[model samples]
Structures are given as structure tokens and as C-alpha cells.
Target chain A: MFRAYSALIRKEFIQVSRDRNMLRLIFLMPVVQLLVLGYAVNLDVKKISLDVYDFNRSQTSRELVDAMKAGDYFIPGEEGQTKERRPLWHLADRFQDGSAQMAVIIPEDFSERLTRGENVTIGLMADGTDANSARIGLGYTAQIVDRYAWKHTGLSPPIGIRSAFLYNPETESVYYMVPGIVATLLTMVTIMLTSMAIVREREMGTLEQLMVTPISGFVLLMGKITTFAILGLLEMVIALAVGVLWFGIPFVGSPLLLLALAVLFLISTLGMGMFFSTITSSQQQAMFLAFFSTIFAMLTSGFFTPISNMPQWMQYITYLNPMRYFMTIMRGILMKGAGIADLAPDIIALAVYGSVIFSLSVIRFKKRTE
Target chain B: MNDKIVVQVENLTKRFGTFTAVNNVSLSVRQGEIFGFLGANGAGKTTVIRMLCGLLLPSSGMGKVAGYDILTQPERIKRAIGYMSQKFSLYPDMTGRENLYFYGAAYGLGRKLIGERVMALSERLSLREFLDRPSKGLPIGWRQRLALAVSTLHHPKILFLDEPTGGVDPAFRRTFWSTLYDLAEEGATIFVTTHYMDEAEYCRRISIMHQGQIIELGTPHELVKKHRAANLEDMFVDLIRKRESDNA
Candidate 1:
């Protein structure tokens, strides 16, 4: 039984190894995505774009302009010579195309009003596409503008405020992002590989051939799982090496714990994929369905947003996500230095998910000659 | 030959909801007998074969295969019999030798036995060079022969093949039928389902199913004489036409 199952898995791995392009994809694509999405396409935005239309050519207005240009919050654009400076503000189409993010507008008669000890209001507009960048751009500009207004007008609106993020600090989006990437990527690899492998057998007629043999469902499942679990471990090793060495991310968590958790996770994904392959009559349907499902799983699996942010019904729905627990464990270990005690719940949930999916797949496996 | 009734089906009935697949069909296949199951496209021959192999459950009645009850000891029955479906299916990505080893090991054969049989089966199928080639690359005839050899690796007391020779060349079909006869001579009962009436000429006894019931059962010669037809196919059409006329 062991040998039979091992043979099946080894056969699958060998087939995968034979395809050179897929081999490259399995190892290379992750690093490429990380590099591009990490440095270039980023969440933690820095330099903000602010456009100014200074109508009052007085020292006060000039001082206000210098102050706006003082810190990293603002990079002043060409004060496009025009009336009302709304046209200058309208020159913000470049920013909409990702050139600039935030713009600030100062009103006319600025010196007379300030000298008379009257308050002046400045207008600020922002591109709010990326909520994270929008927040940064909005916060920094609000602080700078408020300080200038208070010194000149002697007016303070009294409202105390405090804001905090629960999990990660320094707001390093990479720290939050890498853990989710690990879960999403692992799911894509394991399920696609196993489902494609089994579906290929059915297409090529190997499954019906194997069914005639004395290879029981239990033996077949174990063999396939163990073999692919090793491949999944290798994938983890490659991903971690890139994360640590190339991207300068930390391996603060236990590598052993990560791999062990990953094995259980791989089992669940592969088993679910197997069940999927059996239900589907054609290879194309199986592949497309697997793709559709894993994408949905990643989208809703707490990868991009906090579970608390979602409504309770969606939160309840996510309890079924294997990657939800995996993402929690990965982030906890890598970022929070969390141990088994901190992750006992995740591990148990993953174990239960794996066992149930595996048992159900085995029970549902129809060995009919038809 | 082995003093064991290798397969027994008594009043075994399987129904797909209201559509009965096999209706109270009782049959016994003794050791070393080649039993042919014949039917048109929708007949229950394949369903009966599946139930006998323990791949499907009998809706009602009792059956025993290889000294193991079909209902209670299905896993044991599964362990004791070899089966090959109509597709001549083998994993295309793996080589011929790999396919044999996979099946042999699945039956709990040790590495030594698996390795020896892999070589022996390749030689028997004249698949020496093709042993290294992926099964998908080989011609269909070789695949059929290879599938037959793999199913017989563990040498189960009974072998069930569903239309194993459907589309092969005449020469290859001859070899496949000869292989079945050889297995029977070696004390293995062969239960085969086929549409090729010429293939039916080789079986010692044949059961013809129309709709859900085995309407005719006897040796090929007996069936030919009883229906007053020249061959099995005409006999099939004759019997079905009569059944259709009677039903009308």
C-alpha cells in the first residue's frame, strides 16, 4: 500500500518535473511577483503631490508656500499661471494617471485677511484610489495645513483624536503582505498541481486503469499527499529564502513550525482538489473550477483586509477557509514571534479542516468503471 | 481447478431509482471458467460487472466473490479480483514498466516481485522498447495489451474486463482473447463484457442482457441453435426484435 501510493506521488512529481516551463514557474514567478509588488507597486506611500495657486504675492502667502514645501508631505507642482487657480487644480489629471496624489489650493486676498486677524481656508483635493495611500496623503497634509492655519488665525478646533492599527507597526505593508502572499501562493500551487495531476490521469485513462488494481482509496490518498507535501515544503523553502535573503524580510518565526503547519495545509488543499477532480468529468472543467475556487478563497481569506472589518456573516463564512488559519499562523510567527501556544487554535483548525476534507474526499471517491 | 467457487451472484438486483439495471440476476462463475456477459448499449452488463467487483453496491440480494461476500467483505472482494475497463486506460505520463509496478505494488507485492513482473510483463507484451516510453506515446494495440498484463499482475482468482477489445485490430483482438483463455487455464475465472460477437465465440458460456434482465443464457452454440440464427449478432437482433414485438 505504501509503495503503491508512493509510486503514484512519485509519478506525479516526475511528470511535473518533465515540463520545464512549469518548473520555472513554480520557483521563479513568486520572487518576480514579490519584487514587482514589493518595491515598485507598494502600499506604504511616501511623497505626496500638492499643487498651489498663490494669488496673494505677499510674504505671508510665500511663507505658507515655503512651509507647505518644508516637509516630505508635499512636493509643489508648477503654479500654472491662471485665474482662480481652479484651472491650476484642474491640471491634476496627471496625478489621476498616477503621477501625483494630493493637491493643496490657497485662496486669494490672503495677506489682507491675515493682517486683519481673520481666518482663511485652503482647499485640498486628493486621488483616493488606493485607500492606504489616500490615508497617508490626507493625514500628513491635514497636519501641515492645520499648523499653518492655527499660527496665523489663532483658531483651534478642539477635538481630541487617537488612531491605531492592531497587528503590524511601522505600518510596513510588506510585513502584513508577505504572510498573506505565503498562504495565497501555497494554495494556488498545491491545489493546481494535485488537481491537474489527477485530472490528467483521468484524461489519459490512468485512473480507470488504477481503479482496477487493488489500490484502495486510503493508500492512493496517502501516497499522493505525502509526495506533494514534500514538493510544497520545497516551495516554502524557496519562498522563505527569497523573503529573507533577497527581500531582507526576517525569519523571526520557527522554520520547523512553519513547515509542519504548511504540510497540514497542503493536505487539505490537495484533498479538496482531489475531490474536485473526481466530481468534474473533464480536465478543462476541473482546472477552471479549481482556479475559480482558489481565487475566491484567497480574496475572502483575510489576505487583504482584517476579518473584523468584514461583517459577522462573512467572518462566519471565513471559518471554513484553511488559508485564514494559515495566514494567521504565518503572520503571528514571522511578525509577532508567536509560538505554538499562540497558534494552537490555528493548528487545530487546520488539522480539523485537513481531516474532514480528506475523509470526505475518500468517501466521495467513486471507483465505478463507468 | 482451484476447488473454490471464485465468484457467485444470487438474485443480485441493482436499480438506478426506478430504472432497474440488473434485476434479480443470479449467476455463478467457477474457477477457471471464461464467462461472457453480452448486451446492447444500455443493458446492465457493465453494472452487474461493477457490482460483482464490489465497485457498486447491489440494491437487493446477496452475492459472493472470491469467498468474500459482496456486501460485507467488499474490500476483500476488491483485493481478490483484477478488473480492466473498456477504455484500455493507462497513465499516459508514466512509462509502461511504471504502470505495471504501480499496480503490482498496490496489491502489496514487494519490490522484488514488482521488479520481476515488470520485466516479465514487458517481455510478454513485446513492449521492451516501449517500457521506457510514456504509455500515451505508444499505439493503441500495445496499450490494450499492456492494460491486460497490468490487471493480471497480482493474478487474482477472477478477472473482470469490460469490453477490453472494443476497437483493437483483429490480430490484437485475437491475442487479447487468447490471453483470457490462457488465464482461465491457469485457474483464473475471466468475466468479460463485450459487444464484439466474434469475441463471444471464445467464451465457454455467455449471458445476454436486454433492458435490465439477462434474457438468454447458454453456451454460444446453444444460443445459436436456440435462436435458429447463423451467429451471435443476428441472434441478438432476433431476440431483441421478438422482445420488442411482444412488448408492443
Candidate 2:
């Protein structure tokens, strides 16, 4: 068994090495995706372009503008250029041309109201095209305005809520996105390589030739999947390294624990790949099927969006997606420094998915080959 | 070169859904004999070879190859036989030597034994010039030779060749036949399927299958004389036409 398995693995490695396109895809895919998702898919909602219309032009109004600029949340002016104030009537033009995302208008009597201890309402308008950034920008504006009012008016609010964000206190979206990208990269590489490799053999008619030899189906499957598993782990390591070295994302958890769970995650992905190979007759068909499944797996896995934000019914359906548990496990371990006990439920779910899907796919593949 | 019965099958049947591919076929081949299976396209020749090689399970059959049951001892049967599929099935991206080593290892040959066999077969088949190049870049005849070398690396007691010379030129076909003769001379039973009448004439005995049933089986000379035909091709066409009309 060992001899046959080794020979099969050696043959696969030779083929993969010779195929230039496959080699390019294997190494280049993770790096490109890491750079794209790390830089472009950011959701931290920083550096909003704020257009301030200071109608009063008072000392207090200037102080309010300074307070708004204090945090990294807002940048005053148009596209961070030309700090000289533009006419207030041009606000509509600015929002339409996409130069400014938000504008704040202070009432002319803003200082008189504060001196008399009377309430005043400042007008705030936002371009709501990107609802996420718009909503977050508005919330930040409210907090800044309230803090400025409390400081100047000498009136403290009755109740206050102090909330601290753990894991990612600075709220750098790259830290969250890098781990999700790692999970997705592993899934895509393993599923595409395993299914396509097997289907390629079937296309060349070598699968029948192999079956006619003395090698058992078990040996053939292990040889193929084991190679792909190693490749998937290699891709994950590359992605994680980019996350650490390039993105400077912290790895607070145990590296050994992460590696162990990653192997467990591979069982399901490789099984899914084998299952696709059985159902597909050609490399293109296998590729399309694998792609379709990964898209669903990614969306439902909460890699881009949180599962809690999905519809309640859709949330229940996510229970069937193995990547969902893996996504949580990745984030939990890498970001929160979670241990095995802290991630037991997710780990248990992932283990169940891996074993059940793997056994089923193996059985199906054997039956198909026979 | 002996009279030992190396292949024996009785009422072997295979069905895909309701379509019967090999129906109630029975045949036996002796040790070291070049047994020919002649049939047109979709005539169930490949189906029977696949069944005997244990790549497909017969719907119902009692068959044995090299004294191992095809149904119960498929792995042993696989070890005892070398099968060359009709399609050119070697890995195109891999060198011929790599393909040979892979299949050799698949047949459970040790690395040392595989190296020895590969060396011997390369010399015998004159494959030294093509072993280092990828199989895809080799000419068709050279690729076919490489495939044959791969199958025979383990030196099985029986070898099955399905349409071994389907699309090759006549000169390459002659060379392929000579290689087969060499193997038969080395005490290996050969089961080969082809539609070429000239190739069938080279066999000691041949069976003509039509629509999942063997319509005629005998020595080529005997069959041609018994049917009063000029050659094997004429006799095969007559048998097929007769069978089609009978069904009609």
C-alpha cells in the first residue's frame, strides 16, 4: 500500500510540476487575493470627507470643527484637498459629484443657545449611497457633537455607556479580512485542485487504466487527496504569512492549535472536491461545479458578511455549511486568542462536517470507480 | 505455450440499466495463446475485456482468470493480468519513464524490481530513445509502444489488449504484432480485440461478436473455409449482415 501510494503521489507531483498553468495558479492565486482583499475589501469606515458649513463663524463653531477632526473618523474639506471653505450653496454640487460624503451645518445662533443653556439643533446631511459608511459617519458625528456640547455647556449627561472592543480595538478591517481570506483561499485551492485533477485523469481515460491495475480505490484517493491537502495548507501558510508580515495582523492564538484545526477543515474541503469529481465527467464541468459550491460556501460561511446580519431563515441554513464553522474558528483563534475549550462548539461542528462529508464522498467515489 | 486453461467464463452478462451490453457470453482461452476478439463498434468487445479485467462487475457471471475468481478475487486477477486500454491513457505531461515507473509501482513491484524490469523492457522494445520525453510529444506509434511497455512492465501471466492498433499505420501495426509475438513466445497468454481482419488472421483463434453475442468462433482459416468467404473481412461483413437481417 505504501509503495503504490507513494508512486501515485510522485506521479501527481510530476504532472502538477509540468503543467505551467496549474503551477501559476497555485502560487499566484493566494498572493493576489491577499493583496486585493486586504487593501480593497476594507470596511473600517475611516477618513470620511466632511464639508463643514460654519454659518455662525464663531469661536465655538471653530472648536466644534476641530473636535470633529480630532479622531481618524472624518477628514475636513473636499477629497482632503483645498481646506479653504467653499460656499454653503455648493454643498448639493459637492454631494452630487461624489467629492464630499457628508456636510455639517451649524445654526447662526449656536453660541447664544449655549450661553442661555437652551437646546440647539445642528443640521447634518449625508450622502447615503454607501449605506455602511454613511451610517457609521452619522453615528460618529453625533458622538462628537454631544461631547463638544458637554464640554462647552457644562451640562453632563445623566447616563453614559462605556464600551470597549476586544480582539480588534482599533477596528482595523484588514485584521478581520486577512483571516477570512485565509479560510477562503484554503477552500478554493483544495476543492479546485482535487476535483480538477481527478476529472483530468478521467478525461484522459487514465482512470480506467488505473482501476485495471492492482491498486485499490483507497490508495488512489489517499494519494490524490493527501497531495491536495498539503497544497491547501501551504496556501494557508502563505496567506497567513502575508497577513503577518505585510498586513501586520496580530496572531494572538496558538499556532499549533490553528494548524490542527486547519487539517480538520481540509477533510471537508477535500471530500467536497472528491464528491464533485464523481458527479462531473470533464475538467470544465468539475471546475464549474466546484466554483458553484465555493461561491455558496463563501457567502454562507460569513467570510465577507457576518452570519448574524443574514436573515434568520438563512442563518439556520448556514448550519449546513462547514466553512461557516471554520470561519468562526479562524477568527476566534487568530483574533481573540481563543483556546480549544473556548472554541469547542465550532470545533465540534467542524469535526462533524468533516467526518460525515468525507466518508460520504469516499464511499461515492469508490462506488463510481467500481 | 501450454494447454492450461488460463481464462474460463460462463454465461457472463452485463447490463446498464435495461440495456444489455454483454449477454450470456461464454468463452475460454488457453495459456500462451493469442486469442482474438473481433467486433465492430458497440459490439461489446471492450465490455467483455473490461469484465475479465475486473474493471466492471458482471451483472451475473462465473469467470476466472489465472485461477482467480473475477468477482471475488478481483485484486488477485488484476495482479495476474496486464490490460492495455484502447485509448492512449498515459499521462501526457509525464515522461515515458515516469509513466512506466508509476504503473509498475501500482502493480506492487518493488523499486529495485521495477528498475530491472524497465531496463529489460526498454532494451527489448527499443524504447531508449523515447523514455525521457513526455508521452504527448512522442509520435502516435511511439506513444503506443510506450503504453504497451507500461502494461507489460510487471510481466503478467496474461495480457489483454483492446483495439491495440486501432488508428496506427500498417507499418506500426506490423511492429506491434511482432512485439506481441515476442511476449507470447515468452509464455504469456494474450487476449486482444480488434476489427482489422488481417490482425485477426494472426491470432490462433478468434471470436466475432455482433450486438453483445459471439456470432462466430473458430480458427481464422476454419471460419473462412466454413463460411466460403475469400478472407476474414468478407466473412465478418457477411456475419454482421446476416445477424442484422435475422433480427429484422
Candidate 3:
């Protein structure tokens, strides 16, 4: 069995090497996608255009406007002023036209209220179409205004809360996004490549020839999985290099642990590819199925949104997604410098998922061959 | 049953939903004989070959290949046979040598043996010049011959060829049959299906099927004599016409 499997692997590698385009794609796609997606998936809403409707021509209002402009998150937009002087109405137009993502309206309290020790209110309107950026923008706005009020009034609050971001001090999206991209690229490439391998053989009529040979289905599947697993590891290394070297994303974990975990992750993904190939009769069907499933897995893996924010049932559904555990492991290791003890549960979940899926796929492949 | 009877089938049947592709088809071939299976399109020739090759299970019946039950010992049967189809099965991107090496290894032949076999087979089939080139770029005749060489790399006890000579030129087709006869003389049972009636004449025994039933089975000369037809092709047409008239 080992002899046959080794021969099969040699053949697969030879085929892959001959196809220069596939080899280029296998390495090139991850680097390109990682650089592009790492920057594109930023959740930090910076350079948001801010339209201001200051009814009060007071020093306090001027200070407030200056404070909003001090932060990198908000930029003063030209649309805040109009010849007709209907700034409030124009604010709405700015939001509709996408000229500004946020608008601040200050009332006509001519600084008398602050001198008299009366509280003043500021009206803030943000486009809620993109809930994520809206929420981040709202949070930044509240922090700036709260600090400005405290500084101007010279009053220390009776109670205070100080928040510090751990692991990623600056809240750089690339720091959080790079690991997820690695997981996703590994899953996508491994699953897509392995999924098409068998179906391609079937389509070319080579599978029937292979099936009639003395080789068992298990050996054939092992050969396929082993080849793609190595390829997946190579892709992961390339993606990680891009993440760490190009993007400057920190890799604070043990490289050995990451390697071990990546192998486990590849088992599940490669198994999934094999499963898709076995169930599909054509390469097109295999491609569609792999794409559909990988997309769903990436979405539910908390690559972008927080799983904690999902509905209770949906969060439970994520328990079955292998990508979820892999994403957690990746982020935990690369970002948090988490040790094996800290990631025991995630490691166990991945092992279980990988073994179960791999076994099930092998069984299905055998049954299909029979 | 004689020990020399390499393939034995009794009432082998296969059904897809309500339609039967092969119904109560029974046949046997002895060791070292060239057995030809001839039929019209969709006449269940491929289906029957697939069953005997252990690629498909019979809905009901008893069939054995190389002393292993088709239903229960499919893996064992697979180990004992080689199959080539009308559709060229060699990897188009891989050179002929690479494809031969792959199949040789797939059948668990060692490196040294595979090398030796590849060298010998390429020489015999005059494939040495084209062995380094991808099979796709080679002419169809060379590709078919390469596919045949790959299939027989392991030298299985029984070889099943489904329309193996479907598109080969006449000169190459004659050479291909000579290879089959050589293999038969070397004690390998050849179970082949073909559309060319002239190729059917080369088989020691031929079975003509129609609408999922074997209407006639015998040596080419015997079938011609029994049906009172001028040749094997006429006998085939006569058999089909008789079946149609009976249905009418």
C-alpha cells in the first residue's frame, strides 16, 4: 500500500510540476490575495468625511469642531458649508450623496450654558447602511467629545473607566486580518485543488482506469491528500511570509506549533476536497461545490465579524465549522503569542474535526469507487 | 466448472430505476481465448463489460472473474484485471513514459520492474520516439497504443477492452489485434468489445447482443454458417432484423 501510494504521489507531483500555470497560481494567488484582502478588509473606519452643522458661532462650538478634526478617524468635509446656509438640511443631503459618513449638529447655545454650568447636547447622525463602520465611527466620536467636555469643564468625573487594547495596541486591522487570510487562503487553495484532482481524473476517463487497477481507494485518496497537504503547507508559508514580511503583521507564536496546527487544518480541508470530488461527477460541479462550501466556512469562521455577535443558534452552528477553530488557533498563536496550554480546546476541536471529516471522506471515496 | 474457465456469469442483470441495461446475460470465456462482445449502441455491451470488470454490481446474478465473486470480491477482481476504454484514458499533459510509470506504480510494480516494462513496451509498440512527448500531442493511433501498453503493464490474468479500437487507422488496428493475439497466446484471457465487424472476425468467439440480450453467440464462421448469412456483418444485421420482426 505504501509503495503504491508513494508512486501515486510521485505521479501527482510530476503532473503538478509540468503544469507551470498551476504551480504559479498555487503560490502566486495567496500572496496576491493576502496583500489585497489584508488591506481591503480593514474595519478601522478612518478618513470618514464629517459634515458639521454648527448653529452656535461660539468659542465652545469652535473648540468642538477642532477636536473632531484632531483625530485621524474623522475629516472635515467641504459640503459642511453651503451658500444658502441651510447647513442642517445640507447635512442630510451629504449623507444621501455619500459625501459624508457622519454629521455633527451643535445647537445655538452661545457659550452661556457652559458659563452657567448647564449641560449642552450635541446631535450626531451617521449613515447606518454599513453598521460596522458606523458603530466604529460612533465610538470614536463619543470618545473625542467626552474628552473635550472633560478638558474644557475642568471637572473630573466621579467614576472613570480606562480601556486598553491588548495584543494589537493600535487596533490595526491588518494585525487581526492577516491570520484570518492565512486560514482562508489555505482552506480555499487546498480545497479547490484537491477537490478538482479526482473529478478531473473521472472526467478524463483516467479514474475508471485507476479504479480497475490493483490500487485500493484508500491508497489513492491518501496519495491525493498527501500531495495537496504539502502544497497547502507551501501556500501557507508563502501567505505567512507575506503577512509577516510585507504587511508587518507580528508572528509571536512558536513556528513549530503553527506548523503542527496547519497540518491538522489541511487534513480537514483536503478531506473536504476529496469528499466534494467523490460526490461530484464533473470538475465544474466539484468547483462549484468547493467554492460554495469554502465561502460559507470562511464567513462563519469569524474571519471578519465576531462570532460572539452572532445569534445564539448561529454561534452554536460555528462549533461544527473547522475554519472557526482554525481561525481562533491562528489568531491566538500569531497575535496573542498563545502557548499550547492556552489553546488546548481549540487544538482538540481541530483534531477531532480533521479526523472525523478525513475518515468520513475516505469512507465515502471507498464507497464511490466500489 | 473447469479451472480454465476464467470468467463465468449466470443470469447477470443490471437495472437503472425501471429500465434494465443488462438482463439475464450469461457468458463464459476460457483461459487464453480472445472473446469479442459486439452490440449496437446502448445494447449493454459496455454495461456487461463494466460488471465483469468489477466496476458495476449486477442487480441479480452470479458472476466470477479470476475465481473471485464479482459482487463480494470486487477489490480482488480489480487486482486481477486490466481495462482500456474507447475514450482515451492516459493523462494528456503527462508524457507517455510518465503515464506508463504511473499505471505501473499504481499496480504496485517496483521501480526497477516498471522501468524495464516501460522500456520493453515502448520498444515493442514503437513508442520510444513519442514516449517523452505528452500523449495529447501524439497522434490518435499512438495514443491508443500507449493506452493499451499502460493497461497491460501489470500483465493481469484477464484484460477487458471496451471499444479499444474504435478510432484507430486500419493498419494500426491490424497491429493492435496482433498484440491481443500475442497476449492470448501468453495465457491471458482477452475480453474485448468493438464496433468494427472486421475486428470481430479476429475473436475466437463472438457474442452479438441486441436490446440487452445476447441473440447469437459462436465462432465467427459458425455464426455465419448458422444464420445463413454471407459474413459476420450480415449475420449481425440478420439477427437484429429477426429480433425486430419478432418484437413486431
What lDDT score is found at residue A148 in candidate 2? 80
**Best candidate per lDDT, number?**
2
Assess the local accuracy of residue A199 in candidate 2 as a C-alpha lDDT between 0 and 100. Answer: 91
Give the true-contact fraction for every prediction, in order.
Answer: 0.56, 0.76, 0.73
Error of 1 at A231 (Å): 2.0
- Candidate 2 residues A27-74, lDDT tens each? 888899889977887455777788777776778877888899899888
Tens digits of lDDT, candidate 1, A213-311: 667867766677676677777877777677777766656778888887888788789888888877887778887977887887886776765464467
Q: What is candidate 2's local distance difference test score?
A: 0.84
| The 10-residue segment with the lowest total lDDT in model 2 chain A | A157-166
lDDT tens digits by residue: candidate 1, B133-189? 888888888888888888888878889999888778999899778778778887899
Q: Write the number of the candidate with greater TM-score, choosing between 1 and 2.
A: 2
Question: Candidate 3 i-RMS (Å)?
Answer: 2.0
Candidate DockQ values, in order, are 0.42, 0.58, 0.54
**What TM-score does chain A of each model score against the native chain A?**
0.68, 0.71, 0.71
Clashing pairs in 1: none
Query: Per-prediction TM-score, please?
Result: 0.78, 0.83, 0.83
Tell me how far the alpha carbon of residue A135 in candidate 2 is from the true structure, in angstroms, after superposition.
Answer: 9.8
